[model samples]
Target: MIAIGGSAGSLPVLAELLEQLPASIDCTMMIIVHRLKNVPSDLDRLLSLKAPIIEPEDKQPVLSHRIYLAPQNYHLLIEDEGTFALDYAEPLHYSRPSIDVSFASVAEVYGPRALAILLSGASKDGAAGMQRIIAAGGTGFVQDPASALFDTMPLAALELCPEAQAMSLTDMVHFLTELKMSAEHDQ
Candidate 1:
């Protein structure tokens, strides 16, 4: 499983990363992006140019080769059985679809099978979540702060977990592809 975290200045980076990724890379991708209330965009339509995208139905099973985006006004979490759990609970860090919540959930459920990616964003919403991924023996990757359009989120992740692999957006895609390949070979 791969959990992606981002907020402000994430659209371009996300699009680019998705475009570069091979369609064959098999893994469940969960994206936690911050958005305003009553202004929800069709994520499936927006990202369809890149890969297979879906807005997970409530409690839908997580599947490989698909991308899941958090719905409006909800925090999307992963369950132990590879399914989604959407909560309308109060926002964390002033964001409803918090990256930290999704990452932490993946850490608890998938543990070492989880791969957390922190992308460009304005705040430090994902820092603690990245730490949880590490503590759970999962791999954590943060976009290189110098390369990010907004450095705060990635920088915070680096500060919180210095051992994380920080890379450019292009490199991050390559790394994910490699990780997927490795997992497939192991299986």
Candidate 2:
């Protein structure tokens, strides 16, 4: 499983990633982007142009080769039974669909099999979750602070999990390409 957390200045970065990704991958990808309460988002539609993306429904099974976007106003969570669960809990870091909540849950469920990427944002929401992921033996990656449009989020994540590789956007694209190739080869 792969979980990507982002806020502020992250849409363009995500767009770039999706634009460069392979047509298919062997794992499920969950995208957690901080969004305003009650505001409608076209993120899923926008990204679907580049890949098979959707705002998942509660209890929907987590399936490979699809990208799941966290819907606005609710925290998107992964269940132990490999399904999705939406939460109406209080916001974290002043954001619902909190990146931290999603990351933490993914780490707990997927452990070493999980891969997390923290991107540009103005808040510290993803730092502790990245730390938890690392502690649980998952791989974590942070956008290079210097290149991020909003560096705060990446910097915070790096501070907590210095071991998380900090990569430029270009490098991240290449890394993901390689990952996809490897997965295909294994099959």
Candidate 3:
């Protein structure tokens, strides 16, 4: 399982990452991005990859090679039973679908099997979550601040967990390519 979180200035980065992912990549990816309250989102239309991307319904079973997006105004979580659950709780860090909340759930459920990516943003929302994921033995990746359009979120993650890999966009793509190769070999 992989959890990816971002806020301001993250859309383009996410788009590029999605576009570059290997066709045979085998994993379930959950995306948590901050959106304006009550605004309509076209995320499914904006991002494209070989995997099916959808706004997961509550109780939907997590499936491999799928991309689940956190809908606006809801906190997306992974249940212990490997299903999805949406929460209407108050926003954290001034945003619903809080990266921290989603990442925590992923860490608790997938543990060492989880891989988390924290991207460009103006807030520190994803820092604690990255810390939690690392504590739970999951891998954490923070986009390199130098390459991020907005560096706060990535810097925050690195501050909390210096062990987390700080990667440039090129490095990130290369890492994913290697990950795809690894997955193919395993299959």
Candidate 4:
């Protein structure tokens, strides 16, 4: 499971990442962005233009080579059985569809198989979740603070999990592609 969480300056970065991903790459890709409260949003359409992005249904299978984005005002989670769960619980860090909530669920479900990516954001929403992933023996990728438009989120993650790889957005895409290639090779 690959869970990416970001806010503020994340849309462009996410778009670039998706645009660079190979169509044949195999893996579950999840994205959580702290967006404003707006119904009938076009995020799924915008992101799906680059990749096969979906607003996952409850109990959806953990399918590879597809993209899942958290719905506005809802927390996206992976159950222990690898099913998708969308919750309407209270917001965390004043952000619904929170990074921490989603990442923690991924940590509990996939453990070391999970990879959490904390991207550019204005606040510390994703730090605890990145720490959770690390504590579960999972890998984490943090956007380099220098490259982030708002460095607070990534910096907080690094402070919590200093061993996390911090790199530029382009390097982050390369890292993800390598992971996909490695997985295919292993299979």
Candidate 5:
């Protein structure tokens, strides 16, 4: 699995990443972006231009090669059984669909094979989760602070996970494009 989390300045980053990604990749991509509880995911619709995707619901079975968007008001968790479990627990970082919750689950589920990326945000929501990913032997990356409109989130993640690659928008796009190609080639 490839898990990504972002907040304040995340929409454009997510869109650009999606646009560069191949129509199909070998693994699932799950995104948790901080959003208001009642707001519907218009971003999900916008991103469908690139690949098959869904705003996951409770008990939904996870599918490889799909993009899953975390819903508002609920923290999306990856169950050990390869299903999704939505939680309404108190928000971490003052937001539901907490990035840390989602990323940590991905780390636990996929371990060394997981790839976790933290993008632009206003808070440190994903920092600890990035730490968890690295500690679990998964690869970690963060958007370059210079490329982020709001640098705090990425900066925080860099501090916690110093081994994470700091990627600019263009660098990240190129990396993921090549990664998908390599994974497909290996398969």
Candidate 6:
């Protein structure tokens, strides 16, 4: 499993990452992006050009090669057996669809099988989440602050977990693609 977290300046970075990644890449991808209150979002439409996309329903099973977006006004959690659990909980760090909530959940659920990516954002929302990913024995990737449109989030993540890999969007895509290929071969 892969959990990617971002906010504020995420759109272009996410789009570039998606565009560079192959659609057939294995592993389930769960994305948590901050959105406005009760706003109806169609993340699938925004991302479908790059890969199969889904707006996760409660208890929806997460599948490989498909990207799942946390729905608006809810926290998305990863469950055992690669399923999702959505909740209407109050916001964390002043944001609903919190990256920390999602990353921590995936960390608990998949442990070393997971990879967490922290991208461009204005605040520190995902710092603790990326730490959880590392603590759970999962690989953690943070976009290099130098390359990010907004650097605070990535910088915070780097501060929280010094071991987290820092890469440009292109390098991150290459790393994930290589990881997918290596996992396939191992399987």
lDDT (C-alpha, whole model) for all candidates: 0.86, 0.89, 0.90, 0.88, 0.89, 0.87
Task: List where candidate 6 sits over 4 angstroms from the true fold.
Answer: none
The positional error of residue 21 in candidate 5, measured at the CA in angstroms, is 1.1
- Candidate 3: global Cα-lDDT? 0.90
Candidate 1 residue lDDT tens string, 78-180: 8777789998888988998989998999999989888899999999999999899999999998889998889999999999998798999878877878877
lDDT agreement of model 1 with the native: 0.86
* Pairs of residues at least 3 apart in sequence or in different chains that clash in candidate 3: none
List candidate 3 stretches off by more than 4 Å: none
Weakest lDDT window of 10 consecutive positions for candidate 6:
35-44
Q: Model 4 over residues 52-145: C-alpha lDDT tens digits?
A: 6899888888787788999898899988777889899999999999999999999998889889998899999989998999899999988889
Give one digit per residue, the lDDT tens place, for model 6 in 1-187: 8889888888889988888887688778888888887666777688777776788899888777778888888899988777889988888988888999999998898889889999999989989988988998999988899888899999999999998989988899889889978988999
Q: Total clashes, candidate 6?
A: 0
Writing each residue's lDDT as its tens digit, candidate 5 over 90-185 gives 999998989999989988998998888889999999999989988999988999999899999999988888899899878887878888888778
lDDT by residue for model 2 over 16-131, one digit each (tens)? 88787777767889999987777667878887867768898999998877899998988999999999999989999999989899999999999998889999999998899888
Candidate 3 similarity to native, TM-score: 0.97
**Superposition TM-score, candidate 2 onto the true structure:** 0.96
Give candidates' CA RMSD values in order: 1.3, 1.0, 1.1, 1.2, 1.2, 1.3
Q: Which pairs, if any, clash in model 6?
A: none
Model 2: CA > 4 A from native: none
Residue 137's lDDT within candidate 6 is 92
Q: Write the per-residue lDDT of candidate 3 for residues 4-53, one digit (tens) a residue.
A: 99999999999898888877667888999999968777887787555567
Off by over 4 Å in 5: none
Worst 10 residues of 1 by lDDT: 40-49
